[model samples]
Target: MDNHPTTFPPAEEDPAYLVFLDSLDYLPSDDVARIKAAYAYAAKAHAHQKRMSGEPYITHPLAVAGAIVEWQMDADAVCAALLHDVMEDAGACKHELAEKFGKPVAELVDGLSKLDKMEFASYQEAQAENFRKMLMAMARDLRVVLIKLADRHHNVQTMSAMRPDKRRRIAYETLEIYAPIALRLGLNKLYRELQDISFRLIYPHRAEVLAKALRAARGNRKELLTRILENIRGKLEHAGLRAEVFGREKSLYSIFRKMQEKRLSFSQVLDIYGFRVVVENVPTCYLALGALHALYKPVPGKFKDYVAIPKANGYQSLHTTLIGPYGTPVEVQIRTREMHNVAQEGVAAHWLYKDGNESSAELQIKTHKWLQSLLEMQTSDSAEFFENVKIDLFPDEVYVFTPKGKIMAMPRGATVVDFAYAVHTDVGNHCSSARINHELAPLRTELRNGDLVEIITAQNAQPNPVWLSYVKTGRARSKIRHHLRTMQNEESARLGERMLRQELLSLGVVPISIPAAAWDSLVKASGQKSLDEVYTDIGLGKRLPSVVARRLLAREDMAGDAGSNMTLAIHGTEGMAIQLAHCCQPIPGDPIIGSIKKGSGLVIHTHDCPVIRKSRSTDPQKWIDVEWEPEEGKLFDIRIRVEVKNTRGVLAQVAAAIAEAGSNIEHVAMDADPERLMTSLRFTIQVAHRTHLAAVMRGLRHIPEVARIHRERGGEA
Candidate 1:
């Protein structure tokens, strides 16, 4: 790849270096000199490489740097852009760049470089991991993503040189990932360009068709837009509002998406021609809106006051749809000059850190909040991380108010839980319920724009696992999963300790009084860091309590008799590690046996359980005699299969019978045998003991439609 001759673009064709320098017209001489040195170094390093378009590879970095300069990024960002590909392709080391240029530029370049040295199972895995690394780097220094976006912009712009398949893949990735990042960063120009370019590359024929259709529509609407612009300009001037009015055409990709979404043809898309009114001040913006509304009738319910409530990405504009001449629908946006700048530039408006001004600080602060969310989501698996990140990419925002009248911007369809997390992680984790608009609402209730949401939290409340099903934000999902995982670990540790104590008692050793030296020996033998960790592992089924007990006993020189007359009584509330076997639902008052499964602690099975009978021949050592404590009012799950005649209301009758017998149905399923004209109803009912379960079964047998009813062993019929 390096053997290719240098083929530089002509001065006119490649003015990227000059453009970059011109963008830095206000920069100090020292910064300018540093950037120049970076360019020279990168040019020399990439001198031997040539792009598929036959241009010297140096031009690519220059283009990327030029794009970054356009965003008014810092000199370090531009320098980093120039050297972004150096470490990956030109064998340039980050340390070498640090020594040559500076550490900041080197770190930015390192952040931009791919992890090519690490082997991956597939391209997707590598992509996800690379994205993960890139996001981390971005979180550390926002400039990394700015340079990367500049790099991607140039790549997508010049993607035509690649093969069709490669082009499509790159374009799809640009659409799915890069464009969203650009949008997230508030780089509207770059975002639109990326989307349009990706759409063109992925569907050239469709793009061409849309382009032609849009051109034709522009021709037909030329007179109409001209008249509308003139009238709006005249009205704004009459209203003493000094404004810049310009017609704006929607991008091909946006137009295509609208057509696909609304099932409309080119001609049916009436709002194809829009106008933007940039005024001098905030008041003038509203004045311009009123003037436009007076001239052309405003479309009801099509107005949005984003100025008062900015989008999550810090976008602010007053949007309204007006009916133009000839009944044509025309969209108009009104914003002040600063708002226009921020809207178009997004986060970049404040990313130019050299200013050190309040606006820059505000933008950095906003961007940092988003980056912190990415950090919170890092605990998720790679696929889940990527998927959750994707969920945050699209921003159809809804502006809702807290009970205190503080406005919060959330994605459309975000639930109450999302609102809670957006407020704070603690608030979200402890959110017990919510009141939407003064009415009690489910946590999964989708919040609407302008809804007053009041989150009800309790000091001891924790995130519900069920929240993962409806929580919209990645931050909330990650926080919930993290809390659940922590809680599970603590619970598992406790259960493991209990099971180990029981096992040790069986071996004639006191569990609580076990010496620290004995625990240390067991920890060393099991390769665990601490006694609690070992217990946790055993509780989570990573290790067996019996194994750990034997090791502990051996350390104490008491491993002679593994069996003992000691029995560990159960009250049916042992959280996770001690679980009743679903195959044979054992309750209080039933003869039961305890089997220590590796990592799973103790599993309780009825003495008559088929699973236990089947396992005895293969692994008799796993079984231990266990008994339930004489405790009442504890519910246990018992499955009962009832064969009934095919009739309506039969299920209701069977459920009523179980209820009449004082048992609650936990779950129910039905299997119908059409040939036999009978339906098998499987009921997982909660009862206090085996006698109650038997009574429920007898009650079901009394139903006229019931042909046969029997207690189900295990979860099977």
Candidate 2:
């Protein structure tokens, strides 16, 4: 790969290459020369390599560039496609490519290559990371993804030589990721082509069966379809609407998917006859629609006016299902010539208009907005990012109206929360409820096609954990999770700082007085990149705060293990770190001892807790003494077992008494006991502290049906 070609033919000398160059009639003389130069460089770089098919590797890049050209992409995209693999497969570098071609071409090529200077845990993670980088580049310049898609399209076409397992994996990735992305971008033709090929590779038998079935069906319906087509053409011509009507068959992959998704037989899915009507302008599209409806009754509820409200991908058409001759279902899509261009080419149709097209320009804006939003996601895990992106690739969508009458498109099952987030992240974070169609509704209410929604927000409101259960859009789910995590990390960092400062004080070290060199030593010795990271480890209980604090000082300043530690105080507000042990809930005023749980900060237990006694014998060092100075306006949970006489109103009476005592029940459970004619009820109630707990129990003692009551305790070590 390091050896460049010593001898090569001129670009025009090759007859096939000359034919390809001639197709660049739209490109300027300078751009055509640059494309030719890019090919020459790529050919030399890949001279020593051969594809799995035993063909020269240059043929791969040539085919990719040809696809880019067929997409009507500019000269830079064509050049980038030609050189996309050089930096990855050969010894060529980005700097070298940029110096030879230009920065745009180099960046596009870089976007197509896998990430460098990083290590991934697995192939999926590597693929996800590479995908994220490509999206970022594509947002800035749409041509980046175009080159990648083209490259992938060609790869799938030549995947026959790959191993079965590898071929299956590639096919799944194409359908799961690439095909959906293409559809979302409005590349209908490429999208269908990709599915067809990948479907064949993954399930040759199934594809062949579907293809044969479709051929047989078409042969059976040819005469009837031609007569129906003729009648429709005659009707449109008489109505004075100029329309280019043609019949279209659903792709085999589409039919297979419909069969699987809806659990229908092949014949059931194949009966939906498809046709397209391309007119001269927008008015003619509607006129043609009216003419068709007059000729045959339309299938009610199947009419979708995409022209009035376009899809998120800027797809516009008048779609309706009609009961044609013989009562057969005919699906018709009506669009203008310009709309047809966007529908067929998707984002690549931006080049179709010498100036600019509405839907085409709209596609670019929406794509940029969607891609830029990923920066706010800031998910560190590659697999998670990939998973989140899959939601945004949905082809099915619902369009709703904001209070201001502005339209917003969301995924099919997206709820009020999704709309809130789509409007603004802050709105979603603070949203308390919503009013759907002027009626108050739950935040999880699924939006409809034209439902007007008004989001109600509260300043103190934050995302509830339950919101994750119903959120349908990637943006809302990610924003909610990201905000929750950011808040938790911030709280953890602050708690860690307090713990570190306390430990340092016990070690006779004042953090403000410590020299910068000592802090550096702490970071370096702890294998942590910064002081915050060291504190985070301590905060998360991965490392003992005492141990980490001692590392700050040099050996001479290190205090012996005999040093007394300051009693760590529990505020009950430390998020995940420094959590109260659930085995024996120890509230304020309860005698407590702390145990270090790795990956979770100190867990406080009652001093006489049996769990502590059992574990301390084996790991005495894990035990630490702690005290509670629980935060104000916070609640602590304590479980109590009540033995009540079996009666209809006994449960309700017991609950009323607890409420009277100003305590809230967090959970309820029932356990078996030896008591006769009595129901054992376990209630996990939240109170302010030990005094509050006494009040709840004292209130429960007044219930007439209550036979006995006692606070649950961790009995015996």
How do the residues 383-484 of candidate 2 rate in per-residue lDDT, one tens digit apiece?
A: 777778888887488888888899888888889998999899989999999999999999989988889999999999988778999998778888888887
Q: Estimate each model's TM-score.
A: 0.84, 0.92
lDDT of 1 by residue, 564-654 (tens): 4567687777665588888788898889988877756678888888767778667766676788876766888887788999988988998
lDDT of 2 at 605: 89
Candidate 1's TM-score reads: 0.84
Q: For every model in order, what is the number of clashing pairs? A: 5, 0
- After superposition, the stretches of candidate 1 with alpha carbons farther than 4 Å from their true spots are 1-19, 351-361, 498-533, 544-570, 578-585, 591-634, 637-686, 691-717
| C-alpha lDDT of candidate 2 relative to the true structure | 0.83
lDDT comparing candidate 1 with the true structure: 0.83
